[model samples]
Target: MLRTPAAMQDAERHTAHNYHPLPVVISSAEGAWVTDVDGRRYLDCLAGYSALNFGHRHPTLIATAHAQLDRLTLTSRAFVHDQFADFCRELAALCGKDLVLPMNTGAEAVETGVKVARKWGYQVKGVPAGQANIVVAEGNFHGRTTTIVSFSTDSDARADFGPYTPGFRIVPYGDLAALAEAIDEHTVAVLLEPIQGEQGVVVPPEGYLPGVRRLCTESNVLFIADEIQSGLGRTGATFACEQEGVVPDMYLLGKALGGGIVPVSAVAADADVLGVLKPGQHGSTFGGNPLACAVATEVVRLLATGEFQHRSAELGERLHAGLRALIGKGLVAVRGRGLWAGLDIDPALMSGRVACERLMERGVLAKDTHGSTIRLAPPLVITAEEVDHAVAQLAAVLAD
Candidate 1:
């Protein structure tokens, strides 16, 4: 008897019923593929929602982790560690920012951004205390924190999460007029994903981000780009905003910063913007620990080479072309950039979940979101052949 069902059952029995995972038990992964306990091979197309952008157990990242593990691990936030400063400096340079405040998870980075923006508003922007408001777009997915869920448009994420925190104004995404009208003197920041990944890899209209930048500057409001999903070479550019020549006042990065070995996230900004916080304002126990810093430093080194970004740009064209060709066959629409794509299956035929189940049987692993939409965010390291294999698998599933 195979241990797959027993393992899956044990996982489902013990874990909270929050996630309805597909019926697959992966044992190990390398590069862009995973193997199950049954020795079955499957290409990993989801890449942990872009967290595994460098793929599983990348040699450089793993080596860095091992070396750091042998040296030191955690020192809390009370004492400084050897690996801290270099990681901050190098990552700040990569982001072209003056300062970097490290955190452990993407949600923590977002919370840090929110706190910083609110403080900057009162101390710098001259907004009254407790009156700061941050404008967010509709259909945005920042994180699952209570404050984040308070502003979410999704009923599933927001339904029972109240009494919700106030001070967020929702505006239509890709609509400049609504965004402009939503901004007021009390507005301290405009938080958005450069490309809404959870919103089905939705890209805003051209010039929309530039318009947001100009509007923020004109209104004396901070532009906070939540690049946790769209940054670090997932979008063909270092940052998705870079493709449009728009820079946010603060960049919220995570997912790939730890090189898929450990959790790492950060907020990068100029001193004038990120300088509002004093000691003891906000922190995490494991945030900026020696180990996270060590692994993330290597991740920064990888991005600094621009190899992954170039690969994304070159192979993205091929990936998108393949996906687009599936239109009218089984896909109703395809939207994304680089190796990331959100495919809308024909609802009249099958739901996204069923399509994913069928694909799972064919040795391809992906994730489905919303009702009929499935997202494909393969690792940046995936080869052109792997890309084609994934597309071919989807085409076959659609045909079936």
Candidate 2:
């Protein structure tokens, strides 16, 4: 651990103290595993917060990125790049939407969705000018943008970040009646994550998503599903919404869409919704550039095969089952779908942070959220044996 201390200090010395990171200093990684500066390997259960659904340094994604790098990388939105068309078309088709607006980050996609929804409210829904309001859920995590955080319920993310933006109504997540009460004629949209990842992978009540879809349809309000952390085969299906057989008016997608190779996010909707933007009204200079398009297009191709989605589903059953068996043995609860899970440890025994540290010592890496919950999202490329190994390590940590 001699080299690790200096590297950790160097990491914190120049960077802002925005994150409380694990104490390992990783220097290289492959599928399902990473090697630290001291050459200690750990099974990666966090999977870059579900961004690396395909795993670290996935061969196909790296190859595509390399090929694109040799040809071209960036171009302004003022002009079209060669790889733009296929990327947009395939992604739109995958989402079953007619139009797409690509952006560089998940937050930008959310901001774009907010703008588009409001514009559509003015132009299409005929809400009074400057009166379009949005309904958001409590314990939701869309992004860290000022506008997004204005409606957030987390004190750490929301506090001291004001003067906050306005025109949003917050309601308890999974309360169909509360959500219904929040929407009205002035409401332009309902923004939510189908599965609240940061809120300990909290899945809403049964039929809640369908209820929200019905409510939005009945009120003519756009339903914006932020699938950044839950989409692209993370939750067994292509989307978490599909598990409930619900489709929103808009899909804010990112994370695995870029194959964890680049920062790429997008807003997908039909022409009537996304087309509300005129030429100069909304654009990103680095959005849909050659490199992003090329790499993301291949990413689309990978998802098109449906292999990852199926793998996640089959393996997810095993993962959840394994975690459930440990419920009374230090684990109090386990919640999630597919390969994603939030395991709640017995608080009397240890904090989630301490559990993670112990797991690191046992050669597994995962992240904790809330006070007692740790989220486990191993890469889809991980084998059944790897999953067992990760579970075994967690069991050992708890046993100690």
Candidate 3:
């Protein structure tokens, strides 16, 4: 194995130190594995922050990307590309929404939703401009844009990053009464992550999503689901909202929508809600480029089949059961849904980072999120055998 010191030295000298990543520099990857620069193999349990739902270098997605590249790679929103219509239509149909406004990243889609909600509040909901307030939950991660981070409750994300943007209010997650009290005549929308993926894969209390949806509907406030990390079969459903059987007024989707090839994100909602923006209001140059469109179309097809979703559900149960078997021995508790779960470590054992380092040494690669929790999200394509192998590694490492 490559010595960690050399890699850490190189990174400190070259790259920005924004993230404290594991000391493994991956050079290549496949369905469920990655080869580091030193040629050591490790199972990829983090899966590019849920962006690689289709796995690394998937043949079908790669092939389509290649062909589309050879044909037409870009044609900005100035005009139109042949692939845009098909992709938008397919994604909208998958979400059962009336329309979609494509963008290049999850943050952009989140910003688009915010803009649309505020405008709709003024024009449709009849609230005054600049007075349109959005209700957001604590510990939510939509993206890193200025406006998106403006609502964050994390000190690291918000500290000294201001004077912060305005027009947002924070609410305690999974608490319906707090959510209700946060609403006002100026409230335009309530934004939240369906499963809080970045916060140690925390699942909200049962009936939380449905309760929020009901409140939004009754209050006439737009409900927006930031499914950037939990959508596209990541949580054993097309969208995590499906688990609660509630449909939001808008869906902000990213990550897996690109099939692990390119950045593809979009906001899907009924025409009236998304219709507030005029032609010149907003857009991205590469938002609906031909190549991205073709790849995203195929990604939508793959997710709709529910094959990967089924695999996640089945394997997730086995993985959880196996991890739970080690609970009192080393772990604090197990939490999550589908293939995405978090294991909280006991203080007497190692910190999450120490455990992740050990797991990497043993050929499994997962990263820690919060202080003592490691988020586990293998590619949905991983098999039952692979799941067992991952569990075995965790069990072995914790046993030590």
- In the range 72-113, model 3's lDDT, one tens digit per residue, is 998899998799899989999999998999998999999999
User: In candidate 1, what are the lDDT values of residues 82-156, reduced to their tens digit?
Assistant: 999999999999999999999999999999999999999999999998999999999999999999999999999
Off by over 4 Å in 3: 1-8
**Candidate 3 lDDT score at position 328:** 94
Clashing pairs in 1: none
What C-alpha lDDT values do all the predictions have? 0.94, 0.94, 0.90
Regions of model 1 farther than 4 Å from truth:
none
lDDT of 2 by residue, 1-400 (tens): 3799999999999999999999999999999999999999999999988889999998989999999899989978888888999999999999999998999899999999999999999999999999999999999999999998999999999999999998999999999999999898999999999999999999999999999999999999999999999999999999999999999999999888888889999999999999899988998989988888888898889999999999999999999889998999999999999999999999999999999999999999999999989999999998999998899899999999
Error of 1 at 64 (Å): 0.5
Give the poorly placed runs of model 2, Cα more than 4 Å off.
none
What TM-scores do the predictions have?
0.99, 0.99, 0.98
Candidate 2: the clashing residue pairs are: none
User: Count of backbone clashes for each model?
Assistant: 0, 0, 0
Per-residue lDDT value at 187 in model 3: 96
Worst 10 residues of 2 by lDDT: 73-82
TM-score of 2: 0.99
lDDT of 1: 0.94
